[model samples]
Target: AEAGRFFCTAGRGLEPFLAREGLTLGRVRRVFSPKVDCVSGKVFFRAAARPGELRKLRSGERLFLLLKKHSPLPVSRNRGKMLQEIKSLVIEEPKYWLDIISVWRKLHGHEGETDDVSQENALALKRKSEEETNTTSKRQKTEQVRAVVSEECQVEAGETCVAPERTSNQECWIESKTSSEFPPKGSGETPSANEKLGFSFRVSCRCSGAIAKILTSQEIGRAIGITLVKQCGWRADLRDPDLEIFVHLNDIQSVVGIPLFRLPLANREYIKTAGLRSTVAWAMASLAEISAGSLVLDPMCGLGTILLEAAKEWPEACYWGSDISDLQLEGADGNIRTAGLMDKIELLKSSVKALPLPSESFDTVISDIPFGKKFKTTNDAQLLPDALQEMERVLRVGGTLVLLLSQELRRCVDGLTKCAGGDAAEASADSDSGAAPAQASSVDGNSSSLAQGGGESVLSRRFGSLVPEGVYAVSLGKTDAFIHKYRKVSAPGQK
Candidate 1:
């Protein structure tokens, strides 16, 4: 294993979780934790790692090498200067791009032929002489004209025309690329014998902070691309490039690296019926702390994502997934077999309100309940309270219960806690497990559940036996959700 600096791309609140999980690996060192100083979805560290080792990370969406960290950049509002600064910073840096390039190759299953750059585009010269000679010359002339017209249009539309731009498909893209699209050019200089050749790459920039106020991601990416093109021996290929570089720039600092894979680590190939992101699902399971010989249950498990995550991480424990919908149960069944965890996980058809299992039979209950989209509460009754009661009923005393719920339901539970004169305790934003138990909030007397045709309030009955353990805020792109941890007590109103 080679020692190298790297960073993992995490969710907004998952920085600490990722850092902690990353440290659990052998020969990994923490360089910087974003939540400790800056609030971002990245964990910077150094590792003596290979391609296969980092892909096992469950908390982060993607991983990148720490190519270089720039010095404090000015809070420049000048768009032209900012683009120029970005270009100069990249090209001027003394970089060993080959080191990161080797890692990128192994990640894509290209373990061999990494030594010779010419092997990358064996047809580069042949294609350049035959198909691209005349046509490539013509396209360059047309592209220059298009650039002028595009800038004029931008200025007329009240946008900044700081840099010349290429056509949409001229550089890199998601589609396949033909050799004719990119011909190796060297500004009339011939390639040296030792010079690396035919390495195609694309630059992707993400902008935030003060610098973003001046330049868009597109402008920054183009500036970097123009500099890379000056390398004189490589092609810019966005679609199926040999290397992919990423630049995450802010007003104060710039982070540059290469992405490990095309798909994020959160996308699970084993579980085809994934309902929740595996990273978040793994976070949910971590809260449960399923030790060896533990019995875990996901009463409202849809597609069994939570159960599958738990089973994979803690093979010593057994899991049961129950769902009311036959479609969801069938999906879960297929996923269990596909993951090859048939002996570790089991599936059952059941509703959240009632369980077929005996009381206090399970050691932990973890679930990501439906929060009103793709699935809904049946019979127009609230699903939270019924879920809490049934989950509490099956979980043994002192067993952990973890739930992933929306903000609306969280407020409803918070209101119940306040009514009982107990303040809900929130864990620190950067906590490793992302959950800590709050003060015990319980309501006295018997109360009816929504699923039951009785006169009892579901909220009152749900909070009586479970003591709040902790809450973690998680971001899911367009929306935010919270993970709540609780412990079931032997007696009602007991802490």
Candidate 2:
């Protein structure tokens, strides 16, 4: 049960959130990349710890146990320089490299057994990355290519006693070949590269960055692979590699690691259909901070991803999710049934703009609003406002509203303004005066929109709308989204 340092990658803005969760799971060491979109952290944990806990992490995309770090190296336009540096590092510390790979193998076992690599899923990963980038020219070159070594090659190892006859036969064949064909490194004896020399195993390199023009990643990968085979007498298994090395180079440095999991950890069992990513769903749920017995609802639930995630965290909470589409509701129902949370959840076929529920009933509402891209819509832009109004009506005073939205945020706040009963005059005056106009509540306890002074949009008025407690802007590769946490103000001025 020895502890090891590891790193986890998360959506750009949610690194802090993920880091906090990592702290709960283990001792978090560092959360780096403050300026860049890079959101990653290192954690220390026991090698014997259940990986299921890592899988439980909803916000992390990939996790890796640290092997070796080469920090602050000079940027090399020449691919050979970088390859030579990596080669020297590997050749100098071959034993350390072997030990790290061995320990990773021992802990995770053969990735082939648990790693779920399907044609469909792999393609999906590529497509998701492409979508995140949203730039076909750049994406086509980088994200689309899946780097894998082919199975047909091998590196020649010295003959053993058991293979005496074959050894003798190949020995004659070996004598005819020049020693310079594959020269041993660090002996100061320089040898030229030969094309005809066959290896016992094949190596593939996949290169990236400005240096890609000089050499491909696959070419660099092969060079390192060749060096390793020569130094350690290791045989390559490219098709189902005994060891798989990933080398990623940027303008700054190269990150190299042996993957412990074949697939990203976000591929949870409960995810039947894709909608909100489990990580984002988990972030929204965490920000909501719902209690065990709180009444939670997802009015725009599609496939119940958000509710399901919440249910996992707060099993005792009363969960209700409704979708405008019957087909989507059916899908959500199946997922709920598969999760064995039928007793813990309620599914309704209802629109977000008008839920078939009593006013101020839900203690908390969590939802991933339709950006009109994933789900088809007639009025793509109007959904957010209408949904906000309906949600505010159903959510009780001081209730939390956790929303994952991609666009039309201004309109969303505008809808919340009308829902709070704030009128155009008050909204305008609130904007011009740089002060919130006095709010007047109706007999039913709803605030009136009208206030003295300039006529501004309701979005301009503060306390007149739902009180925003937290806002997280999430950058998921090519996609941009936001998670907003709001507390319904207690019946206008009553608070």
Candidate 3:
């Protein structure tokens, strides 16, 4: 099989997230508008216009093109309307060119007309008319051109027209012309073309909810030229698609598309839960950025959601997940096997504080830190702190740690970090001003609290009691606590 393009979709307002990781906007190929499903109260991907001048593109180059062509409209009713309008344009104007000399002769006696004009004038007029026809016909092939014009815009049937290649400078004017005037006057439109076009591409994010939205949004899939052939339960993996589109829906919208072969997260079994949230996927992919070839450890793996996502995101790395509950591990194992990723992951049973792995082996650690009333621990207070110490011991000197917890558990993490010889600090120091901490209700039936205050206060309060300052001395530990701090790193000697 040929190697496919590597496509990475982003969430709304996440272009900056990709940019910070050294990815540029120019690498994207298309961005769909967002649509809301009235029945589900959920948003989905809508089809979008494909960027022009992509005929020569290699499969790998399309993702950047998608990002560069992102929609400018706000992802709301306004965006839905815009999608409708663009689709209408494509359906109404489907334009095509045909050699029209014979048709012109049939319509208006070609020999007599040529004889009447001077030889030079005949040639000039022919050239001029052909130029006009070429311009008009070229528009028919464009998405916008097809949207607006209906009648077959062809040269007289027997006439031949050749299109001259234009420079990049000339392309802008041509695109503008096609977008504005491809369909000149009256033309019937097709309903299929007008149906809101949706496009999506597979992204690095491994969240299930985000994946579901992409699979269900026909508009988004069609825009990127991907067809969802099947939807069995929450996960559908299509093999014979031109591209795989991923739609990320929030209050905001982001759509991405890439050719089928470049789909990094193709295995559905890797998605542990059908109801995984988009935020969690974003967090997993972001955390994958911290280490190279480092083993990831998740003590409270639950259904192995984080481990599965991490394994896909970092294929070069190994993953180990353990849980106290055998039922959750069984589900996780099934998911891993279903995804065909069992080779990359190892699952075991272990308590939070007493993991089977050796110390100083893991380079990065991440977990969803269980909470809520459903999960009862004999000593809830001691559980979190002890887990933190184990993580510290297992993680290498220059390693990284990421934990997802409720606001109340923040104090535990802080106290543990301090006890582990690192300063207690919030990871949001670099967050945009006035940004609220991301909030998600507990899946295990616990009340949720917003993560406010700085890292110190949040952690202190969550874990109960303030951790002593200077308990752990900061040595070579540089805390990369910012959410967007996961920068891609080259292997030790590679350029």
lDDT for each residue of candidate 3 in 1-495, tens digit (9 for 90 to 100): 211123333333333333333222233533322221211111222323232222112111113222212232233344344344322211211111011222222222244553322332234334334544686643333323222211222211111111112222322111110010012222354425322231111222111233233332333322222111111001112321112333333323343322222321222434655423323434544644445677877778878777766676567888888899988888888888877887989989998888888867877777766654345543444466567667666765556666655444543344333322223233333222123332333445444343333453444233222222211111111211223111111222222
Off by over 4 Å in 1: 26-39, 93-95, 99-111, 118-162, 165-197, 378-381, 417-462, 492-495
Clash pairs (backbone) in predicted model 1: 172-238, 436-469, 436-470, 437-469, 448-456
Candidate-wise lDDT, in order: 0.65, 0.57, 0.39
Query: By TM-score, is 2 or 3 better?
Result: 2
lDDT comparing candidate 1 with the true structure: 0.65
Off by over 4 Å in 2: 27-48, 109-215, 410-465, 493-495
lDDT of 1 by residue, 236-293 (tens): 5554456667787775568887777666788888898778888899989988979999
lDDT of 2 by residue, 205-234 (tens): 334446565555444555565555434434
For model 3, what is the alpha-carbon lDDT of residue 29? 34
Could you say which candidate leads in lDDT?
Answer: 1
Question: Where's the lowest-lDDT run of ten residues in candidate 2?
Answer: 172-181
Off by over 4 Å in 3: 1-9, 12-293, 371-382, 411-495
TM-score of each: 0.76, 0.68, 0.42
